[model samples]
Target: MDMSETSQPTIDEVDLLLANARLRDELEPYRDESIDTSTGRMNLRTENEYLASMLAWERAPALPIASWFTPVLELPPPDSLDDDSLNELLSATIEKLYSQKVVLRFTDHLSNRELYKIIYRDILPCCEKKVEIPGKFLEWRCFEDTDTWLRYYADAVERRRYQEEHDVRMPPSERPKYRRDLPH
Candidate 1:
C-alpha cells in the first residue's frame, strides 16, 4: 500500500480533528485545574469528548424558546381559544416542549388557559441557554411559591415539619384547581 493512502485521514476524522481544535480554543480562557489537573481516570478520547460536550454547553446560544423548534412554535391568543381547543393545544404543546427537553413543573394550580398563557407568553418567548446536553432538561415553574409545594406535594408529616420549622400556621391542604400530567 502507498504511504499516502495510509497517512490520509478520512472526512469523519478531519471533522473530529477540527471540532477538537475548536473545543480546545473555546476552553482556553476557562482552563484551570478542573480539566488540566483531572485525575488519570478517563482515557484521552473520553476526556476530550467530555471536554467538548462541556464546551458545547458553555457556548450554547440564549434564544427565545420558540426558536428552538424546527418550524418555530407559535400559539394563538389564549382568549380566542375555547376550553377544548386550549386543552388539545396545551397537550400537544407540552409534548413538543418535552421533545426539546423542557419540562413544566407545578402547573396543576393554574387553569388550562392560565397554563397555556404562561407557556405562550412567558416560556415560549423567554430567552434561555439552549444547551443540547443529554439528560439535561430545563424546568419551567408555572407558579412561584414554597407554599404551593407544601400544599400540593408534601405529605402530612412533611407539612407538619415545615410548620414546626418555620413556626407558621400551615394552610389547609386542598387539591390543586387544575390537574396536568406534565413531564417531570
Candidate 2:
C-alpha cells in the first residue's frame, strides 16, 4: 500500500462523515462526527461517539418535563379504582416514558400509588426543563432527597448496601441519574 493509504483515512472516512451529517437531517438535521476507521489511524470511534452524543444533547429540543406526563401522552394516568389499577397504570407509564425517551430511577421506596401521585402532582407541573433530541432524552430527577427518601423509604437491603458503600449512610442524591439509557 502507498504511504498515503496508511497515513490518510480511506473512503471509510466518508461513511463516518456521512453518518455525522445524518444526525441533523432528522428535523432539518445538521451534525458530523467522523472516525477515520483506517488501520493505524488512531482509532477515534469512541471519541466520535462521545462527540456525537454531546452534539445531539446540545441541539436537542428543550421541553418542560411536565409535558411528558400529560393526559395527551400515549399512555394516560392510572385511575385509582381497584387493587390492580395502580400496577396497570405503572406498567403503561414506564412503557410510555421509555418510548418518549424518559427514564425513572432510585424509586424503590415509594409504593405504586405514591409514585403515580408524584408524577401527577410534581412531574405534571411541566416547569422543569428537559433536553430531548433524536436518540437522546431528558432525564428528570425524581424524589431523591437522601435525608428524606433514603432515610425513610429505602428497604433494609438497600439501606444496608448504601451504608456499606458510602459509610456516610446517605445517598449522594435522593435520586441518581434519572435519565438513563435502556440497559444495552
Candidate 3:
C-alpha cells in the first residue's frame, strides 16, 4: 500500500493563540493611567498594535538626548529682547529643533517674544525626552484650544464673517491632531 500521498497534518493555531495571550499577559502589568491615555480603542488590531508598540518601547534601549541635539543648547531669557535679536535667536533655536526632528507649527500668529518664550521655556526644558526608537519626533502643541485663537486672535471682521457663515449656536468639536486619529 502506497502511503506517500497521505494527507499532511494541519498546522495548529494553538501556539499563535498562546503567544498572543502571553504577549497580552506580559503587557497587562504595563497598563496604567499613563498607558497612552490618548490612544483610542478603534478595534482589537489597533489595540494590539498599540500594545506591541508599548512593548517595543519598553524593551528598546534609551538613547541620550545629546544623540539628537549635539553640544547642547542654551538660550537667554526671552525677556528684555528686541524683535531683531529675538528673531535671530528663534531662527537658530528652531533650526536646532528641526535637526532633532522636532517640528513646531501653528506659531505664525504668536509674537516673536511669545514664540521665543515657548521655545526657551517649554520646548528647551522638554529636550530631555527619552529616545527609544529612531525617527520618532515630538510635536509641541502650543495651542490647546484653537477656538480660543480664532475667537481672540482673529480680527473683528473675520470673526463676524465666520459667525455669519457657520452655526453660532455650537462650535464644532476640535480635537487635538494627535488624538484625532485615535479611536474614541
Q: What lDDT does the true structure give each of the candidates?
A: 0.84, 0.57, 0.62
Candidate 3 C-alpha error for residue 32, in Å: 3.4
Q: What is the lDDT of residue 54 in candidate 2?
A: 56
lDDT (10s digit) by residue, model 1, range 1-184: 7777787887877777776677778888877666562526875466568877777666899999999998999999999988999999999999999999999988888888888999998999999989988788999977768888887767899998999999998877978978777777
Colliding residue pairs in candidate 3: none
Candidate 2 deviant stretches above 4 angstroms = 1-6, 14-42, 65-71, 74-83, 127-141, 148-184
Best prediction by lDDT:
1
- TM-score computed on alpha carbons, candidate 1: 0.69
How many clashes show up in model 3? 0
Q: Which wins on TM-score, candidate 1 or candidate 2?
A: 1
Q: Root-mean-square deviation of each candidate, in angstroms?
A: 6.8, 8.4, 9.1
TM-score of 2: 0.52
Q: What are the per-residue Cα lDDT tens digits for candidate 2 across 41-107?
A: 3345544565566555556555655465565543345464454877677667666766666676545
lDDT of 2 at 174: 44
* Candidate 1 positional error at 72, Å: 1.9
